[model samples]
Target: MSVYNQPRRRVIQMIMIGMILLIVARLFVLQVVEKKYAKLADANAVSRKVVYPSRGIIFDRKGKSILGNDAMYDLVVIPANAKNIDTAYLCQILNIDKEEYKKRMLTAILKNGRVRQSVFAPLLPPEVFGRLQESMYLFQPGFELVQRQIRSYPYAAAASILGYIGEISPQLLDNEAYKAYQMGDYLGLTGLEKTYENVLMGQRGIQYLVKDNLNRPQGPYENGEFDSAAVAGKNLRLSLDIELQVLGENLMKNKIGSIVAIDPTTGGILAMVSSPTFDPNLLTGSYRSANFSRLYQDTTKPLFNRALQARYPPGSTFKPMIALVALDEGVITPSYGYPCGGAYYGCSRPIRCTHSGGGHAANLRLALANSCNSYFSHVYRLSVDAQKFGGIKIGGMQKWADYMHAFGFGHRIGVDVPGENGGLIPDSAFYNRRYKGSWNSCTSVFLGIGQGEVLLTPLQMANAMCIVANKGYYYIPHFVRSIDNDDTDLLAKYKEKHVVAHISDSAYQTVINGMTDVIERGTGRKAAIEGVRVGGKTGTAENKAIINGVLTAQKDHSMFVAFAPADNPKIAIAVVVENAGFGATYAAPIASLMMEKYLKDSIPAKRNPVVKFLLEANTIPPAMQQKSKLDSLNRKAAATLKNGAGGRTFR
Candidate 1:
């Protein structure tokens, strides 16, 4: 019995040992065989570290810096994980009110679902972070100071073109594309910043770091081998010439207008100067919101991108486009003649020509050279008449309007710049809406001479000149020349041509001859550049306003469009001076000065004896001096024409 009892006791002991062994094996699997799973569980108790990538740089075509980034520190608090934080002390140190602190805390909880830690608000100016550092002991263990990139536009004054950056809103983060971005990430808000965000924003990277129970980072878990470094965003090389841009800004001082200059051959924008421009740098950093709101509320609207947005009547500048359309459509041959005789069709209004007193009968070539309204009126009427045979009339007013559309008038130029307005080109549909289908071509006759319901942006006007320069095709206008840091493949795509309008080579030469004559002996003589064979047209559109229940014409909008080295044009420009009367008097001279500056590195000196005489002729009152000189010039021109003498030659 003793021996049996001993064996049973041994077996019981063996069973106990087997149970212990099984427990040990289970512990080994949970701790050693699956240590990664256990480590993940521990990680849930610690904090996370996120590294943000730096934004890209924006450079001028010459590689000069326009916009770049600077390092900043953001005070990030994890509301859910923040424990026993001294709220009063934290608010005081961060220079925030208690209400603001509570609001941010609640927003973080709601945005991050209270399940994980998230940043409550961004720390701006970096000084806020310095204050937070001093009060770190009062903050929650999970709180952190994360480094961020703040956008900086160094040039400042190029705000309209460079644009500004702002914090991303809640809606933007909901999109799948922006899911990777955390709250408080800065985004390009306007201008080129918003236009090329995709190329300018670089790839994000990740780093795995170990953290303690207090949520403090303990460097990299695997000696930094597992971390991925962020790639800086690619830089953009814009086609804008900074020197010329500054020059243009200076020239536009105390004025209200826009100047747009482009290289006809490449469609490269050289200078896009809008008067009353604001500093882009003012809209950067901590004071961005306050300054932006102030600028936006200003009456002048300095933020308005006038170069691509403002639309106005092409005025007399429309004459050249009308001539080209008439010549191309064969509404009238170049030799078709008409008598200005002060008016056309014997209308009671007498549609007076710009010619002094009353003008003489003129052929098409001479009419275009003199900008004869009667000649253009005859051609416009003939094109609109269905009874006129052998006149290339397919659709009457509609067809003529289509030809203008083909010239890029009354349309957007599809420039790479954002917020481009498609200036109104009143068509049959537009008239139908306004007149309820009762308006006829005669009802909108003012459109024939480039006024009334016909509007165009400076960009479009310049592009029209480019179309003439190209003799048919036009490359889509763009600001970015290339991505500075990108491979050649990305830039190759921009080199492709985007043709807006196409005309026959023969028609182009004919139109070129007309423009050339305009500078040689017409209203655009003021815009002529010596030795360069420049061609251009001038316009002065009446500005009418309602006064005491009557439409009263007051100031005029001056305008000019020109191309240089007429035979092989390199530059095309459009100048519009609001409320400045007579295109030849104001806009033409400005355009000429700009052209001379661009082509010859200086404005052509005032060599004309008449110009010199006018400058020195101070006997007349200041108010009447300009009018007196203009009247004198008109008399001189009329005397020369009456005597059958050649027009004054520009030396």
Candidate 2:
């Protein structure tokens, strides 16, 4: 009995000792091991401030700074620290009423819970900042002026391409993609700024400052032991030539359309212009919000990126690709001829040809040079109904569509730019759904001449020209040439070569020769430059839109696609001019001017008249302007149109 009692006593003693050790461990964790509550307790006396690093600079291929940082200030506030401050004087300095001051204070409190700091007024002008800085000490620790950097554009061009930055939205704050960002931070809203945001937005730094009872900053906390330095963002280099971009934008002034130019060798975009572009500076600094609202409400849609988003029928500009597909499929040879009297009579509704001379399409090259509608329509039918794959429904049309897909049609070409539209390229399945599988090649004959079901973006058309210029291979079109200090494989795809149609080089040579003839002696003669050999195609795309609740035919959209220095092509370009009749009249000259500028660095003095005329032409329909509800919209447009040229013959 004595031994059992001894063992029980030892066990009870051990249990008591274990309880004491647990209590000591808990105390150690609370007072020493964990620092969170300690930090919270010291929060009243210590202020942890965030330092935002300057964003990366953007340079053109020639190393000129297109986007750079401008010095600015942000007014920050801590609600709990606000005490004995001169609200009235502060309001006067900020140029805000008392009510607005209270509202802003309440907003800052709501954003940061009265303890942490939040933006009271962001992107303040230098004059306003100077005034605020003079009386800052009167406000104690409640309000502080923090240095900031805002985007500045010296050229004030490429508004759509450069995009803008704005305050982060609550919705974005909740997204995992923006988990690192706070409410007051600014983020890219569109264009290249949005695409390279992660690389451009550098890491934030933290610094701790000791505070007094009155919330005034005393000195660095613990000699800045917990401070962290910010890392600067990596710079970026773009393939865009700002001068070329300015030239394209100037040429597109008072017009409604887009121009996309690419380096055929590297697939780097040389110049991209969406007409009606606003100055990029309008979307920067303190006036961004108001100017943005004005630009957004403008009926001309100055914010719309037509080069990447607008879809149009390829028109006769698509003839070379059709010729490639036919040549690849053995449905037509380079010497294939058609004598349909300048019109395709195979279809129930005859498709007219720009070449009206009898027996004009004596060969495939001759047909392409003359843009004979009858020749292409016959070739399209032959490819879709060839015996190689059963018939249109069984395999022929699908095979044809396969060729289209290989050529980067019916899918986005994956340009580095955002908001690209994969233009439509119809297949057998599409026809099966639209026509209940009752359609034949002749049923969709308009597609043969690029007028029906087949639509393409200006980027896609330019890429197609690259494929032709390179004799079947193309690189993905991209804007940035390289990113400074970046080692990631994010841009690997752009360097890859895509072989489309798998057509022989000889077949491409035939098509290219015909295009050269178009600029030399055919409809696209206006596109020919002085010393440069240019291969080009002119397209007069039929435009139809509903006006006054009735579908009516409007003026044709002028279009042209070209490659220059025909022997060793460098630049491939596509231009579209809305509501402008005849591709040869407007689009061809625009392309020619751009080529001349790119190749020769400036338009020849002899072609100065052509440049002046193009620089001053307005083709927007009068009905469209009258339909705009914007007050004085038509009047403003008319005032600008006064500096432009009048129309000549449609063709």
Candidate 3:
């Protein structure tokens, strides 16, 4: 009995010793091993703060302010640190409801941990911020009034091109690329802003600041050694001429369509105007909530970038390219001739020639001058028919399409701006999908005349004219000419010549001759400039629309393409007006005005006696109304011709 009791006593003593060792180990962890964690917990009880940097600025080509920053204040609160503060008094001072304050506090707690750090609420007005600052001491320890910068667009114009920045969404914040950005940081949403975000959004910096128990910053920590300086964003000098852009926008007021102007030598976009444009300032700040909703709901879609986004049939403006292909393929010489009687090739689908009294017989030059469909149809068929060429034809519809591709159609031009769509250039794949491999060469005849499945943007159309003006190659169109405060190497990528095709210099000469005739005697005479040789083409594309599930003919789309100083071409332009009768009537006049402004710095007065007479004749007798209409149409047609195509008469 004594031995068993002694063993039990030893067991009890060993258990007590093990318990004492476990307590010692716990005390060691709490006092020594976990000292850093304990220190952090104690520091959090005293103060915590965050610093936000100012956003960058945006400048135009001239270094004039396009977008800049404005000072504002943000309302911030810390749920864990806000204690024993009168809720009613705080709400009154901050100009917020009690419920809103409560909700904000709950949201902050959820977003941030239960730490004493300040959390940002939505942006507040300057007045509200002022009120909060006035009574800031009355609030809890962690409440703060943080000054911040807001985006402001100075010009308010070029909304489509400059685009706007907006707050980052939750999903965007989750993206790896956006990990560094805070939830409320602004991001480029469209246009140049989106395209050059990296260059525009400068590097973010950080610094350490000592704070008091109230969480207010108490100057820099460690003599500012820990601070990192922010790098300002670089500025862009776009090629766009601000004065011309303003002028173009004003001229197109109350109209629907677009106008694009390019410097043929540099591919610099001089002016791009889309009617129904909105002020970009509407999208940049505290006012964005109300203004953006209004802009989004507007029926006209003023936000759309019509110059680069809208696609339309090349119409007769495409004839120049077709003529080039025909001549280059040896399908037809400049001397080729055909009869035009308001139709082409006697096909059942007769094309109505703009010429009066049905149509007249035409040669290649005359055909382009008069815009005769028959001669073009003959060349179009001859250029593409292998069987007609005795199986030796290398210039067919596919070859014509390839030439169009070389002209920068049916593909993206790789402009620096974002949201550029590769306008459709139907290939065998597209045709197979549409017709299931049953389509043939005859099915694509309309493409010869720049219709059916062939689409082009105003920029593409202007580029085509520039290509022709340059006599062959063209630089890829770009907006930024140079970057401000950047080294020359910054533009190395853009300085290289982007040759789309290398047609022989002789081929360009033949096409230029026809284009010259079109301006001197053909369909673009109205686009002529005094003391300056100008070449151009006019197009009147038939409109088809679905009405009650039935396709019907509607108003025509007027279009014109022109280049100034034809002998030494400087500027090339394209203008399109939706539902605007004839190309030579409305479109040609506008193109002529833009060229006059660009070349001579002023519009030339209306000096054509025929046009002046027609203007005055409109006030004449009622019996002359029919004659007046015909005279007006003929004068416009003659102007188009005198600008190049119809001066030589082949009797």
Candidate 1 lands at a TM-score of 0.81
Candidate 3's C-alpha lDDT?
A: 0.70
Q: In candidate 3, where is summed lDDT lowest over 10 consecutive residues? A: 642-651
Better TM-score candidate (2, 3): 2
lDDT of 3 by residue, 1-651 (tens): 688699899999999999999999998998788664465455443333334445555555456666676666666666776888777977776677988888888877776555634345545655666777766766757576655555655444577787877767668877998887774456777888888776777766665566666545567665555466767666777877676676676566545578889888988887888865765555654556656665665555567778899888978898888888777777777777776655554455666655544334346667777777666666766666756434212334456667779989988887777777678777656767888767665567677677778889988999999888988878888788876577657556666676656576677777777777888887788877778888888898877879799999877888899898888988899998777767887678777777787777765455455334323322122442333232332243335334532211111
Best by TM-score: 2
State the lDDT of candidate 2 residue by residue for 1-651, as single tens digits.
Answer: 688699899999999999999999988997899865576576777877778888998888799999888767889888898888899998888889989988998988776689877889887766788988777778877888777767867666777888888888778988998999986787788988899899888999988888777556778887876788888788989999999998998899788999999999999999999987776766677767766677778778878899998899989998998888889889888888988675678978777665666656889877877888888888888988988899778898899889888877889888766898998999998999999868888887788889988989998899999989999899999988899999999789989988774589999999999999998888899998987889999999988889799989888999999999898998999999999999998999999988888888887788889888898787876765555443343233334324321100001
Q: Which stretches of candidate 1 lie over 4 Å from their true place?
A: 1-46, 107-123, 134-137, 210-218, 346-349, 356-361, 386-394, 436-439, 485-494, 498-502, 544-554, 601-651
Candidate 1 residue lDDT tens string, 537-615: 8887777779899999878877888899898887888887766678887678767767777878764456445334323
Q: What is the TM-score of each candidate against the true structure?
A: 0.81, 0.89, 0.80
Best by lDDT: 2
Clashes of 3: 28
Q: What residue runs in model 2 are displaced by over 4 Å at the alpha carbon? A: 1-45, 80-84, 106-117, 210-223, 623-651
lDDT of 1: 0.70
Residue 65 alpha-carbon offset, candidate 2, angstroms:
0.7
